[model samples]
Target chain A: MNETQAETQTEIALDVPWNVVVHNDPVNLMSYVTMVFRRVFGFSKEKAEQHMMEVHQKGRSVVWSGGRERAELYVQQLHGYLLLATMERAI
Target chain B: MNIERDAEGGFIFSDVEASLAAMFRAIPSAADPEGSKAALDRLFPDPAAGKEAGLSAEWADYVRPELREGFENASTTVEADLEPLNAGEDGWTIPRDHIDAWLNTLNQARLVLASRYEVDEADMNRTAPYPPESERTLAVSQIHVYGLLQECLLQNLE
Candidate 1:
């Protein structure tokens, strides 16, 4: 309610980091997966490919880790684009 | 076109074009073509009985005439040989290599369409003004198609 309290709350909220993970699935093509990463995360082609490779080889990869809210948003957007995406707290 | 959410909470597109981009990616290439073709055939068989059932001319125009005719011919052939291959149980079982070739063809089509329509990369990224229902349908189809593809590939592997 108070200004100081509200300010502190905002700062605290910004401190938490969230992890965004893209799970491996059977259907989506590897190239298409990379393209989705580039389109959603604005990653360079190389970086996107790298992440996509990680998913292909390892079954899943943490494409991103950041604030919980933003991570959720990324997961939602990726899901919207038909990627199997999820989020969790980064330990 | 408008989109609607079905009882299952999945998105349904008023026009197939909104979902075609993602659908086009499901076809397999030579290396992984069988699964891709199978998926494509499952979704778009020749004659497209689903298309004929109750589709509008506007929706029909979403399909390229040649592609439409190809589907029809393919479906008919598959139907004619259904007993031998059990093809009628499903649709045509597209070989993976053929699917891959189809993907290349689709990419070329996209390139040509982009140029013809003057669709810039930036413009493609810009949010198109779609009805909420349509947007939801696009979202659902995009996710469902990818999920289904992943499932089919896994099934083949098993």
Candidate 2:
């Protein structure tokens, strides 16, 4: 509740990694999904293709895991491209 | 699949597939095919139109003959019943099937562009600090793609 405590909490929270996950949707094509992963995360073609396959077979995949702020931004960007995307804390 | 260094020593695609893929993802689907085709015409306007004469050659590439023709065709195919409604007026409703169809088309275009340009998805994200003109084109293309999605959603509501 004090300023020092609040500041400490903020720093701690900022250090936690958040996970960015893209959910499989019937609407988006596999190729488009792969391209989005490449474009948004700068993933290599092979890596992007792997993730795309995971999404297709597994129904979803955690594409990126990083700071919450960055994760949120990635999720938003993916959504902007009409991908079904979300973010959550990595367990 | 070959990468070369640009004048600044940064990476550049020998093939344009990645950039093309990005653009394709940003195009709207043809719904009510005729209406979509018409809308595209109004947006892109003319074929064989040149980019402003003085612009750099790279910038000029953004304005292509196919762009005008594609828009015209897209506009005609999109549904006209979904035209933008005024404030306080009820908007058109989009059907779930239509949304799915549009998304499918967007995905197909993405594939075509990527294959045509021979750029992988990861390469697209890795390209940092895009030139201003290229960035502008991507932004504009995204807006158009989103607009089509919005239109589909509106139509389904009607």
Candidate 3:
């Protein structure tokens, strides 16, 4: 590939957003998951419950999306709450 | 067993019968996920979900230990809170300060029990009683009871 085209591709890869996803688990209480989302993300009650319900119904939900480092940090906090969470490239 | 709220917003589990007390006392042990690989995996899941091996390994090396330590600390707090029940008292009082620990430890125990038994969503949703015929059945009961306790704490905190 051309030099500029390669650089553009490299920049795209470097700038790719990461998503913090929470997967549903029967063992974890729905209320508890909502609480974690609220606490970790400072999400409002309505917003937190919305995402919690999404995870519960859909098996998983991207709870947060941002820089890879921040996504990793959010995943770490969700894990601290014992929720099944992971960070992945948005693409 | 009767659960009530104290003036300080803590839980007061009074008249806890022997059977329930035994269950409560077992919390610390049940919370330990060391023996079962599945339980350990549940407690310390990969942060990158296998997509990034290096990130997952770094998490295991550095972050997993912190998570384990946090779980252990929560269990310790719960164990200390159960002293009254441990000392032959009919009931136990969870001080307001230790509410979060109790919640965390109870959740940990439930997760461990569920993992050890290979419990799934259908099992959790089962309405009929598990025929108490094996250790696996007993683990199911433990998970339900611990789940109830966690629910109580969450409701009270609301």
Off by over 4 Å in 2: B1-158
Which rank order by TM-score, best down to worst?
A: 3, 2, 1
Clashing pairs counted in every model: 14, 37, 0
TM-score, second chain, candidate 1: 0.28
Candidate rank order under DockQ: 3, 2, 1
DockQ of 2: 0.02
Q: State the DockQ of every prediction.
A: 0.01, 0.02, 0.87
lDDT by residue (tens digit), candidate 1, A13-53? 67867677886654456666776788789999899989998
Q: State the lDDT of candidate 1 residue by residue for B76-140, as single tens digits.
A: 43233223223112222334323322333333233223333334434344555535665333433
When just chain B is superposed on the true chain B, each candidate scores a TM-score of 0.28, 0.31, 0.95
Q: Candidate 2, residues B1-158: lDDT per residue as tens digits?
A: 34343444332322334444343323543221233443333222221123223322422255433334443444333233234221222333333434433443443343233333333434344446545666444543443454444443334332
Error of 2 at A64 (Å): 0.9
Name the candidate that leads on TM-score.
Answer: 3
Instruction: Kindly provide the TM-score of model 1 when superposed on the true structure, using C-alpha atoms.
Output: 0.36
lDDT of 2 at A91: 55
**Candidate 3, residues B1-158: lDDT per residue as tens digits?**
99888999988998988888898899999999888999999999988878899999899999998988999999999998889889999998998889888888999999999998899999999998787679888888888889988888898898
